[model samples]
Target: MNINDHNPLPTYHAADNRYQEMKYRRTGKSGLMLPEISLGLWHNFGHNADFTLGRKIIRRAFDLGISHFDLANNYGPPYGSAEENFGRIFKKDLLPYRDELIISSKAGWDMWPGPYGNWGSKKYLIASCDQSLKRMGLDYVDIFYHHRPDPETPLEETMGALDQLVRQGKALYVGISQYSAEETARAYSILKEMGTPLLIHQPRYSMLDRWVEGGLLDVLEEKGIGSIAFSPLEQGLLTNKYLKGIPEDSRAAKDGRYLKPDQISGDKIQMIKKLNDIAISRGQTLAQMAIAWLLKDQRITSVLVGVSRPEQLDDNVASIKNSQFSDSEITEIKTIIGA
Candidate 1:
């Protein structure tokens, strides 16, 4: 059945067939299994966005078997707005299914003013987690991540804080994001000695970016820690959005913070066009192909996706349908992306 077929209802009753189409992958050695396509609140679920539209998109996602919802403390434009918004939606539509969902949040990066409000210090990570729980109206988050590594703070201290959170019951499991191979290994070692094995790692990976491939994936394999890739679309560059020059409303045109106008060079556009051809031959959109490419590696536990609307989820989730690739297609993709 089409999960997105219905209109607004006074109450939200999730589809009984929600788990039929979507696939679930075991998260490393953990008992937890995450959806192949998880929803992220990194964009368009903030104070700047329409509340009703965001709610509709989230409900639609759950209907399609997306049980994981990813968020960060500073996700919204105003910082914490996304969690506040998710709190409202949880109370209204998803509270009943809370046990069936895998909800995660992160800390690190500049969140509030002053030194205590940022970084990987036990103070900041602990305080930020408390604030996030209050904002999201939850007793604990399923997974709490140290969003990025801190140079000043010792790795032991940071991982200790995560261990403390798990022990204290503020977070069921702990993970890290954006750490290098050396750092991931170090963090894993520290957490292992502390008896709170690092559950997963979140990294920015895509056809356009392959930094994680240098050494991180190998480390994850050796250590038996799972990985979830963010930015699998590379800020929408891998999609058909920029095939005919940047639109006025495109992310590159408006959000200069991440996807800049200068980054989309003439050569880049040509490469995207070539990739689009490959996707067409495979009967999938470029976005779908990009996501499917990442999942081809069994080391990648899941691919985190963000969408401005619910309809976008329909296409992204379908990536699992045709994840297989011929050797020739793989070689062609490698030659095109220069990876």
Candidate 2:
């Protein structure tokens, strides 16, 4: 029997109408459907965070119709702690509803010290998926991704491992994140020829950062691979929190690891305040506008959002309610963004 079997916890029956409000979009041409707003375990579900709070946030996300939970091998401050903690909760709270969830993990960044630990290689990819499954206490993940491209490793070998995982019953689908448009095309061709089509691509996209717009979106569209926008708020740059100045507890201030204080330049702050005004005019927060803006592009499968609190989930998910943009509204937004 599982060690957690004896531990008592609050009952977490999902909301009956959880699927009613939220819309599901097909990932690429595949049958897999993901919620419009998927929750990411990149920030709050780490080791140093409170376990109870993590559980609460997860439960709230589920209650709000978020069935997809994204994770990575190097997500935690201490590494693997998010998955370790989530595994405990899964065994306890979400075990019975396992079929209702879509869990994904990646392994491209530096997950360990050794040279073999990081990057995409046949051995490293396979081993990292196993480790991730073990940490999440799952038999298989819905989608296992190559976190990033490895210029060192041959694409054929990396794609082969992903294909092998699908055939090995370790992963239901495979994806790539942070690959360039050309690289994504090459991967898609290789994977398709190998008889294991790439399902989706995750890219860093927001009003502040629009690199994906150049050709990435078109590539995904032509290739029939879905795209999920990560950091859609640009590490909170597109939000009102940084309007006046960075708060002491803001991600830029506290988590200098990825978001830095210097990154918040004066020009960006002026742009954020302008975006905030538009958000207010639309009766939504700047964060919501940023999210809604991403969703406006039909090619985007979903906007992967990271929330520190349950209320933030409520706000982000609400963006879907008014995601439509008028001709002039789009023009105005693009003008302000200098697009």
Candidate 3:
């Protein structure tokens, strides 16, 4: 018997009606189904954060029907702290519900030191997946991704590493994040030849950043591969938080690691205010309307969102309630965005 087995904690019973409000979308042409709004641990769940608060946010996400949790090898400020904290939380509160969850991790960015630590070489990819599995305390991740494209590494080598992971039972599916449209097509062809089809593509998409609209969304639609939009709120700029300048506790004010203060210019603030008015007309927050805008496309499988508090999940999940937009509303939004 395990020594820690004697130390029992309070039981966590998930809500029985958790699936009633939220909708699940099929991932690409695959059998997997993910929630419309998946929880992402890119921020707020790290060694620097309070463990109890992180736990509460995670529990609340599940209670609201968020069954998928996204993570990366270098998410935390110190790197790998998010995965470590998530591993502990999983063992404590979510262990029993392992089969009900879809956990994903990536290994393409800078993780450790020296040559072998970063990039998308076969050796690096394999070793990084092993390290991530050990850290998350899981035998297999549902979807393991190459976090970014490596300029130095050949696509064949990187795609091969992902295929090998699936064959080894280390990852059920393989995905590529932030790959260009041509690169995504090449990856799909390569993975198809390898007999392990690429499952999904994660791209940074929002009203403010419309790079994906240029060609990435078209590629995903033609290839029949599911796409998840990260940074769907443009790192909180699409929300009402920046209307009166950056808040003292905002990501921009604190670290600006992702969303810098300078990025929120006067013009951006004016645009946000305009969007907020439209959101109010729809009976939704600006953040909700921003998320709903992404979900307007059928090609988008899910929108990955990060929340600092549990209450935020309730608001984010409620975006699905009014995902459909009127023709006039769309036209007005495009005019405001100058698209």
Candidate 4:
């Protein structure tokens, strides 16, 4: 579908569906409230994928009360294609419901070649956001984030660009992803000093990955900055998809760049099997149990999940229904995963 280059903003109308069934949690101390499970266009929704089907997934997500949509400058396989594809759907269908949506885009990863292409420099961050807005066909994003920390660049300069984006009305709030506790605290202080507090912190927290529990959670709790975890399923390793070995259509088999075959060792598979057994005993699928485990932490504002098909979205959303975990189940899960 071709989105109008000069499309006008349409009137807002909330979708009439089971909106109240999905839980909405407060984003830390912020006034914004996000869906417990937010949809992200990280792996799929690219130019290489079916744009029509991608649009359907997005519409279905909104209809299911998943108002938050996450994107990045380099999300598409060819880079910038996901945002462009979403721009088409936005103008065609979602523009009218923009008021009911929380659209976010991030930068700070390698997008273009050359010196100013990557990092957290003011030039790169600001220009990247502008390019993202153009590709998204929107005036401003609800949240703009630095995808990762750049040790080469000063934190002051990086946080300054985020503050400037808010001042210019190009972004409502700012966030940082994949940053350590020290880095988050420094950036938080800098943004707060500039009078624009850091809104959210995106990390990779899953049943398999527990690095955030080290000190990141403590720092965020102290500062009142919300956290949204990406890859909460650990690139699908936390699910039954890899229990019998990698399938031909699995992410590892399709895209070896992010998840390689060698990465799935015998020990990892054994751990997965054990975890799956625990999930079965709990009367839930491994995917459901994994997502529910992350939601157990109240500090986690949302879990940003990727979906290649509609069924995957349905399965992930169903996780919320069985989020409660017994103390014994938690202990067994930790022992199985060695967490």
Candidate 5:
């Protein structure tokens, strides 16, 4: 378990009981079964963060049955730095467990400042896949997602690139993130025709945000497309950290990139406190309850939870201990979230 400072060949072997606690769910109709809770590298895996800490989170998560590690080409402060750091960690710790892992990378947002650096064009996607593979030091990722739908790029061309990747052995499964029900249907049809079944859909789902409940989740269920809910805590809004008010070190105080202080207004704070009370009644932290709420739905294949520290990861993983909710609790939660 100790790292040889001289050679550093990554002698880390995950715990034998890694798969004992968490249950794996089948992705849509595919044979792949992801852990109930997956780890996403959207934060704290960048260059600004300590590489050692990031590596520790990955190792501990693996030991806790988090076999899926989600990443993207544009996921770091300096763009592809997260993938590069993950590649380094792969060499230092996870290379041996590669087969046991389900790693995914996305490309659809603006990566570079040029024209071809963004969107769903085949050119950009193909090149970005190659770059991501190089940065992650992997031969093929389990899933490669078109980060978002492009209004301009033809769906055929965009999905065709993913088809090519699968055929070329660069990516095993293809998915779409943030695609609406209509767009997802079209994309799925095209990929299906191209011989690559759309594996899953990544969407932001939580108590605070119920957009997925409108029609997207239904689309996924009807089409047998698996779903992994991201931001299930609503960027920390659903956690106890903002129940009283935003902390000085919260993501809102320092960085307003995605979360803003104003979003945690008086009304929102009150709601969060009420939700926390409900969570406490369930014998769980608000964070754990938030995740458990998502897992209550069998259609939701997994929940992508991101953490900065190993303790945070431990808390998130404990959510699986109580993933069920009574019908009365669900009704109360819906009323509380203003549904």
Candidate 6:
């Protein structure tokens, strides 16, 4: 059979064999469900990047049963370009099957220069969602999030903007990212009082980063808010691509904004080697092991990962096939990371 030849154009149906390997999990106590692994356009789906390749990655992810796609208004190096590129993909490929997907976009970072363009102020959050919807060619998003905490803005006001988004039918659910335990609790109560439950929380978590362990995880458990961890591989530090040195095609080499050369310290490299050995014992790569480790916490609803190529998506999806970690393996990982 010709790879591109088919009588009936494929729709987003579960019967598609490529989707059989994907797994879906419920988000906390909510009725919403998400794939175990969700794709994000945080790095590679910008306007300057190959748009054709971005479309391929999005379509391939859908074919492989990745239903959730996470984006933010300021994701691209040249901010807003990622959403514009995804807008093209939406019109070309995934528009017909929009109902079968959980598409989310966020605001709350430095999207533009003016006061109304940044932070968690009602003006920024509300306006950003409108711009994001326009850019993505969507009527409404499945989820809308505050990309990060805005220290200057009142938490009540920010939550009010999110609540208003739901009331206006612009977003089905709302979430917060990179918020501390205290801030999350405060926002959770405000949303709850407004009759809009906080659906999920996105945080930077990985083998090397445990900022959420002490309090944030407990708060989410108490409030029944689901979590989807971003940078689960620590911005590719957990992957073997950095085991020797930064490869030419690696994110560190391509984009130094997030993953810089200074981040690959001697101690981090040693930890990666030790963790890689442990992953080898489990018959997994360090990337796979890192993902599985994140999923071990049932409160974690999904692992939000970014991929530069199709092969990376394939490898990341394969991690779900072995999500389990034995008690001993967990303890060993803790020892290695010194958690």
Candidate 4 overall Cα lDDT vs. reference? 0.88
**Residues 1-339 of candidate 2: C-alpha lDDT, one tens digit per residue:** 112323354888888988988888999989999999999999877777767777778888888889999999988767888888789878768998899999999999998888789999998999999999999999999999999999999999999999999999999999999999999999999999999989999998998789998899999999899988899998888888788778887667866675676777888788788888888888889999999999988898899998777888899999999898889888988988999
Q: Best TM-score goes to which candidate? A: 1
lDDT of 6 by residue, 200-267 (tens): 99999998899999799999999999999998998888999899877887668986676887788888
lDDT of each: 0.93, 0.89, 0.91, 0.88, 0.91, 0.88
Q: State the lDDT at 271 in candidate 3.
A: 88
Compute the lDDT for candidate 2: 0.89
Per-residue C-alpha lDDT of model 5 across residues 1-339, encoded as one tens digit per residue: 121223333568889999999889999999999999999999888877877788788989999999999999999867998898899898889998889999999999999888999999999999999999999999999999999989998899999999999999999999999999999889889988888999999998997887888898899989899999999999988788888787887778888686886798998888888889999999999999999998998989999999988999889989999999989988988888888
Question: TM-score of every model?
Answer: 0.97, 0.96, 0.96, 0.94, 0.96, 0.93
Model 2 residue 289 lDDT score: 91
For candidate 3, the C-alpha RMSD (Å) to the true structure equals: 3.1
Model 1 has an lDDT value of 0.93
Clashing pairs in 5: none
Better of 3 and 4 by lDDT: 3
Model 5, runs deviating above 4 Å: 1-10
Question: In model 6, where do residues sit more than 4 Å from their true spots?
Answer: 1-15, 253-255
State residue 48's C-alpha deviation in candidate 2, in Å: 0.5
Which ranges in model 1 have alpha carbons more than 4 Å from their true place? 1-9
Per-residue CA lDDT of model 1 for 305-328, tens digit only, reads 999888999999999999999999
Q: Point out the higher-scoring one by TM-score: 4 or 5.
A: 5
> Poorest 10 consecutive residues of model 6 by lDDT?
1-10
| lDDT of model number 3 | 0.91
lDDT by residue for model 3 (28-143), tens: 88899999999999988777787777888888999899999999989886788888889988988999999999999999888999999998999999998898899889999999
Model 2, residue 326: distance off in Å is 1.1
Best by lDDT: 1
Give the higher-lDDT candidate: 3 or 6.
3
- Compared with the true structure, model 3 gives a TM-score of 0.96
